[model samples]
Target: MDWNDRFAASGPGEPGPPSVLVGREDLVPTTGRALDVACGRGTVAVWLAQRGLVVDALDAAPAGLALGRAAADAAAVTVHWIEADLDEGLPVTGGYDVVVCQRFRDPALYPALAGVLAPGGLLVVTVLSVVGDAGGRFRAEPGELRGAFADLDVLVDEEGGGEAHLVARLD
Candidate 1:
């Protein structure tokens, strides 16, 4: 999917915030650096900023980053927005206290995702799943999230109803 186009097509939603990766707050650090991968419109990034974490958010879409910047300004928080394609892989520096990737699936980047975490950092991810629906290429198979992030201490893991969510802490 071309996230850039999707974001370009979206009009800004209500000024209020929404979390792309719902729940899993207990796993997130109250204060520290955070990263939001595929951060369309910067909802999660701005939210983390409001939670007092310095944030670095990345997406291939410039339009999305622009909206994210507006949201961060409205929230009176600062977030660094990077425009880049994830297919090239996650940016190589700056470890994060929290890393979030929601509703964007690219299994090829799983290892890089895990490596981006700082020690004791939290990883929250959600993706389309095939557990409760007919299988498809984009839908994660049952246990896929668990296996992909097996190195972490999975705080919450769920797969069903064509969705998968995982919250884990890096060792």
Candidate 2:
């Protein structure tokens, strides 16, 4: 199903920390700007706002953004939700303290992710992998994340069970 239709059929659930940050929330700074690209339902956006960061979350689906808005409201935090097509490139500009891209893969945008990081900024990403599952067109091959962001100081890099997660910091 298309993203809009899928989100339209779903509810705005509670916002949770991004998967890569589940037990490593300390890596996040309490101040400064954050961006959640492909922020489906705005879960990471609301979660970042709750942590006291100015957050901007973007996705192509209006229905997903609407659900994200509801989730943000329920969390009592403000998030600048933007409906934008990532295929057109990032809608916002400037460096950010945190940049998160979860469950989305776009090798073409990898450098842009690093380019928008402020000094000491953190980048968290999770994507489907070919490591331990049937490979698909959308899955990253071995060493893709680490290789893609080799310039950054990698804090965490792991791949298994058809998933890859990476957490890196800009020096």
Instruction: Tell me, by TM-score, which candidate is best.
Output: 2
Q: Please provide, for model 1 over 33-78, each residue's C-alpha lDDT reduced to its tens digit, 9 standing for 90 to 100.
A: 9898988888888888888898899988888898888888887889
- Candidate 2 — worst ten consecutive residues by lDDT sum? 11-20
Q: For every model shown, what is its TM-score relative to the native structure?
A: 0.89, 0.97
What do the candidate models score in CA lDDT, each in turn? 0.82, 0.92
Off by over 4 Å in 1: 1-5, 13-24
Model 2: per-residue lDDT, tens digit, 1-171?
999898888767677898778888999999999999999888889999999999999999999899999988888999999888888888788689999999989999898888889999999999999999899999999999999999999999999999999999999
Candidate 2 lDDT score relative to the true structure: 0.92
Any runs in candidate 2 off by more than 4 Å, and if so which?
A: none
Superposed Cα deviation of residue 8, candidate 1 (Å): 4.0
Clashes counted in candidate 2 amount to 0
